[model samples]
Target: MFRRFVAIVAFVALAAALTLVAWPQLLGLQRAPVLALAVSFRGAAAAAALAVAVVLTAVGLVLHRLRRGLGVLALLLVAFAAAEAGVLVVRGVGAPDVPVAQADDVTVLSWNTLGDSVPAQVVARAAAENRATVVALPETTEGRARQVADLLARQGSTYTVFSRSQQAGIPARSTSVLVSTALGRYREVTADGDTVGVPSVVLDPAGGQNAPRIVAVHTTAPYDLDPATWRSDLRWVAARCSERNVLIAGDFNATIDHLDGLGPAPGRLRTCRDAALATGNAAVGTWPTSMPALIGTPIDHVLATPNWRFTGFRVLSDDDAAGSDHRPVLARLRPAG
Candidate 1:
């Protein structure tokens, strides 16, 4: 009986570990009818880890020789699992994305123009009202993006970079960066990625020795898109921003708990749930502001490096809801000095 119980415990532990390894992949299946499977990835990973720890603990209590080994392994597994679960839970529960500032710092804002209709004017207004030092706009058309730049110029913005479409007039369905004279004073360099819509910038305030790099990306959504493709694109974005103070902001088109291969990138990237909700509207819903119910998921997002913190964050939807479906988002950031 004791031997049988030990075997059962080992089987359960092994099963849990296996589930953790494949849970993220299973959720990526965009076409999969099991919607619950996709949304439950984080919870499932946490459960599996706990189950493994419990089973190992039980087995360790019964086995005299393997007690030390099992206890050590179980403790390690539980610690790692708890840490992972804690981060996910904090993100899922919706924490503030705004920075808690001290005194001297620069402010940045990120928003999706919802295809550049009236939303453009709204974003322009919001930027002007807030006096954002740097502005990031995603899903902007060539014409609409120019309009945003022009609007910023009216409010004292001098430098701007818009991604050009394959055709001269058309604009890539990506994102662009606009900087005020204050930000431009720091040497600015922008690089447009091929596979993904990413423009990275390095800012050296006053041409100082220590400068920070910011990579802005507009990630592809999984809706009817392959997770593998999204993963490849995300990998490219990650590679470019690796080991730097990267700030990924734009319409991700994928929720934090988005379904895997079933949707877009399976294991590569995730929506920052806390940031999304904090900067999104309760009534406005997700992107394509027009069809809130059909695509009811918070897709737009802004993720900053650990060093860069937010002071204020909000989703500008009430007045901005003119022609487009998405609401513009604003965030005040405080980069560590």
Candidate 2:
């Protein structure tokens, strides 16, 4: 009787896991509160499924004569797990590496500074090391932005800082953008009154005729508190991306999966992860610095329009020790002919 119960429990667990792995959106499970937890840890779920399959297969082989029916069920579970494993592998594969950027390539760095935890000097050093032409900091305050700008100036960088206003009594988070003087003049662009906290700025290159826009984004996290606002914030950013000559970067709070219907069209905004995968580094994640990058969700990104070609992409794992919960994403891009 006890052995029968064990078999039943294993079968139930495997079946539920398989359903989630196979088709989350088919049953409206993607938005379900209970299933949303599974979506966030899809990588870990795949690993767990593989482990269960191996254990169950071993048990089935050992007791084939005593429990022929159990052995068959175990085999079915193994097949389902294998299918999920294939999906995970394909999703995790890195893109092929493009050639390293030329001397004139523009490098942009995006990070969420977690309010005041990250020191201005650390941010400055990282920007200097990468020689970033544009830096986007989400969840940064006005005072912190100034400190970062001052630190960069000390390092011989002439970066002008633009940030959303921080009301005296309000506890709202702000996004900040730092444009290097070498990139020419730039000004802030408003994205309607509702989305004031998300910073958008346009840069007029010193010698180039066209002006490109940069948006530092931080959308609300989709949790029990208010998932609607989270979805709305993402749509707003997507609308901005619909325009030409724009580069959107920072903590989007949504993964590539969550961005499905939010953008102008499918495949409209080019994600840096494509370059990272091509370069054989798709395993690198950029959130919750405490966890290994391979398993953490990559909520931070540097996405660009079709007008720019990505030459290199990297998730700066070394910055995990820099006090912020998110590691920085840096991408090198050149204008597409």
Candidate 3:
């Protein structure tokens, strides 16, 4: 009886785990708690599924004599978990080859500097190395943004920086956009009277022809501390993406899966990570520098309208060494002709 009870409990637990992994949004748990678990599970879906499968297999082996029916049920659960894991692996396997960027391609880089622990020089060097035309920094201040631009200028690369802070003058948290002089000038786009607390700016092309309306954004992280505000902030950014030719880049604090609610159909933003996943170079994880990238949730992103084609995407390796908890994401794009 004891062995059968243990087997039943294990089977139920495994089933619940698999269900959560399969459809996280369906879970009625609190938004923040479920989202946090989903992040880890989604980042390593195959692994999570496989672990459950292994547990089920062990349970089956142990209960083969005590309850033959329970043993068969456990075996079935193992098969189910294996199938789920296979599906995840198939969807996540990256493309074998991604085309290189051309001179005509526009490159954008986004990174969260973790309260300015990364030096301006490092940021500048990374931008130059990646040939980034636009750079978005979250958790950065106006002064630091200018300092990075200055470093880039010293290296013969000129960029115009636009920054906005939540507070006027207290070294508060901020978001910044750095547009290369080569990409023409840009202006700040403000939210008229709304207070979702996300910072953004827009870049209007020189002749305003064929260039994308570039927007840099940083949404709040979804946690118990402020999940409602975080969701609202994401909705605001999503609404902005509904317009044509808008390309947004920054730390969204939510994944592609979490974006189902931010919709009105047809005008939803697409992530550059999709292209990377297709090309086998997706940054499976982009947070908490301590964990291997495959296990970390990719929160930082470069998103664009359907009119643009993503040629290449990469998450910079220098992020961990620079003391930031997030990795830098860079994407190369070309207008769909």
lDDT of 1: 0.52
- Residues 241-303 of candidate 1 have per-residue lDDT tens digits of 454455555555555544233222322233212244333332223455554322234555555
RMSD to the hidden true structure, all candidates: 10.9, 4.5, 4.2
Off by over 4 Å in 2: 1-17, 21-37, 54-85, 92-103, 165-172, 191-209, 263-283
Alpha-carbon TM-score of each model against the true structure:
0.58, 0.79, 0.80
Full candidate order by TM-score, most accurate first: 3, 2, 1
Candidate 2, position 274, lDDT: 31
The residue-by-residue lDDT of candidate 3 on 77-111, one tens digit each, is 55555654553454453433335667667888888
lDDT of 2 by residue, 242-263 (tens): 6677777788766555555444
Q: List the residue pairs that clash in candidate 2.
A: 94-277, 94-278, 95-277, 95-278, 95-279, 96-278, 97-278
Q: Answer with 1 or 2, whichever has the higher lDDT.
A: 2
| Candidate 3 residue pairs in clash (backbone atoms < 3 Å) | 94-280, 95-278, 95-279, 95-280
- Candidate 2 or 3, higher TM-score? 3
- Identify the leading candidate in terms of TM-score: 3
Instruction: Report lDDT per candidate.
Output: 0.52, 0.68, 0.67
Model 1 TM-score relative to the real fold = 0.58
